[model samples]
Target: MTTVERTQVFLLPDLGEGLSEAEIVEWRVAVGDIVTVDQTVVEVETAKAVVDVPCPYAGRVVALHGAAGEIRPVGQPLITIAPLDGDGGAGDEPAGHATYREEERAGSGNVLIGYGTGHGGSGRRRRRPRLAVAGEPPAAVGTGAVAQTDPTGPADAAPAGTGVTASPGSSPALVISPIVRRLAKERGVDLASVRGTGLGGVIRRADVEAALADAAAPAARLAAVPDAPEAHVGLAPAGDGDVVIPLTGIRKAIADKLSRSRREIPEVTIWVDVDATALLETRAAINAATPDAPVSILALLARICLSGLRKYPQLNAHVDTEGQRIVQSAGVHLGIAAQTDRGLLVPVLRDAQRLTTRELAAELAATTAAARAGTLPPARLTGGTFTLNNYGVFGVDGSTPIINHPEAALLGVGRIVDKPWVVDGQLAVRKVTQLSLTFDHRVCDGGVAGGFLRHVADCVEQPALLVANV
Candidate 1:
């Protein structure tokens, strides 16, 4: 007697916000384990945020489509879940393995924008049928093959070249996902590069990704591209005497953004020295009176930035060079430059215009703390109309900061220290700091840019100008 069971493949849902791909940080379930609808099955990290992907179907976990740490694009199969029973189980077992049957492509009645589901609910659903060759054994179905059971694993222990070996006589690596194949093919990777890391030597998406990364490494790409410039740009292959660090993950993201900013934006910086004596005293007085929650220098600077933006709204905007447009924002989404263990991350405070000094301080503290802990969501890292960078924490006096792309301007504040100033026609020591503004010339001219910086300086010099408003 032949018994048939049906399974459903859950594609990774659009985690919202136009993100295309996410890395599989971890999986919460295993094969043969029961799961219910809306269960958190996996944690994925996109370019902007780390999100928990939920299982939309209730069934037994038949297979995990990708391994942990593998990057999967949108609409890719994340997991395969099968219905519990055709007749509630408790029946005679089949000989070796039940013939895997095909299922329709109707998603769990759940999907994100632009991929499978669309308007009118009539979007053509694409079915993915992962099947075993006719007469082929299905023992490898949903098999969670352990990584090379070596006496030689990828583990720290064990000598190299002593791990599990796939003899040429064995069947080609049991691959179930088309994504894995497509990835390898796109990168011109040989599927036989090594044994698959999946069940029964079934290759996982991670294996293919690793192959693609290895092929794209600087050492490997030397023969593919002209090497003269890259060598000067630190792209040369490492020698025995050299320790080469590859740009990857967050570092790679930073490199790409900085390069694009430097290449596309024609930037110019203007600086002014401000006597911060009054501002310092005002902040101290406020803190001394409150003692509960103190306003930060960043918060004060942010308040002044918003005020300055109000007078010169053009600086708080984005430049759409492709459209030949200067887009001015109605409100400020203030990005505070934060240096964290992960790297330099700019977390935006949405609609910062309406926030009071205390509230701004709280938000800045929270945002910076979250960034340091690497817990800030990806969405919070983007969409800024202006940026306030306090380089004083780094013990620097000023910087010609690169403008955060799309945004037209960045305000940099330097360390406030005792500096000689002419007061009442006499040389006096005063608390002074440097303020610099880097802007895209397309947005505004020097007259407007200078005015904005002058307004900030005026507020910093006469704290009452800003403190009263706060």
Candidate 2:
């Protein structure tokens, strides 16, 4: 019997929630390394969060598809593996060369939520062939290098007068990813005029962004000059000690999301200064009673926010811009805004309304720690119906924070400090804190917003109100 070896191509799986692409952060497995089923092969950073992608096959890694810092579209080839047989030789039938029929039998039975290798089939869409290999340098333009053809082929190639050059038998400009194309179209950037620095002269998201910046350079320079005409002015060259950082990854995601929120939502901010002395006392009493499961002020505030939402369910919802309707949530998936080294990440606590104060504290502590460590899965970072921002840790008194996109509201808590308060007509020192609610005006009028803020203030001023409401 003769043995045949065929390499299996593992295409990138569809990361859930309609995410189309991810940037390769790091590769855990190298070519020629043995990998077991469900072993993490690479770490990828999506627009929303960082995720570790696992390989479903057990084999020897033959090739890695993309290099670190490269953007790979979902359904593109990610890795290749060759199955190992007895005596460390290749298998009788290489799984990679197997037909669709053989693929049914060779399925690894592992799934990554939206994608998997099962009896049904590998849910991979065939993409355009890319000539670039991992660790290979990108092709330089105008250097007589033949441009690679994308899926569109020569029919959609850049024209001869568009400043893009092409050698015989190659397209003028290559755009392998649909994401890159959409970005260029949205930004009104002419693809032919923009130089591609990606593998095989392919244009990338960064290329589109750079083209936009270049287009705006003249206007930026004009604004810097005093009473300058609308003429092209050169920007001063960078001096020594000037460092330029490209906005990418999490920082880019944050910028896009916040920009969208600012653009789309009609927001309003209302604040109140409340005496938090009672809230502090209540926490002390709870801790004294249950030291093992002590509660935090944030947890107490979270519980209060849930209570407030119960009364004003409109605040616990998001707007459907296309549908032009306000969609309220049936349950509270509270998002705790935690500032991590990576950036600001909000980890959702599902069914938070049902959790006790102690449980909320423990879960919040664990999730916040995981977020800071950058070990949180992508699923935990999304689907937030409402966000709670505790900027008090930053020593700020109050902030009118932007509402988290899609979500209708955000409750911001400030640091609690001592202040003079009149109790029974006598001035006395009391713990004071400022509470601000930044909400989408589309969800509710000022009356409802004010009522919700007042309810929270009442709870903070007199913790007994929470007991009475309960």
- TM-score (all chains, Cα) for each model: 0.68, 0.70
Candidate 2 per-residue C-alpha lDDT over 93-203 given as tens digits, one digit per residue, 9 for 90 to 100: 334433332333264556464222333334332222332221222322111222222333333332111122233444345665544554454344556566789876777
lDDT of 1: 0.67
Candidate lDDT (C-alpha), each:
0.67, 0.71
Residue 292 shift from truth in candidate 1, angstroms: 1.7
Q: What are the per-model numbers of colliding residue pairs?
A: 2, 0
Error of 2 at 42 (Å): 1.2
Runs of candidate 2 exceeding 4 Å displacement = 1-5, 91-105, 109-241
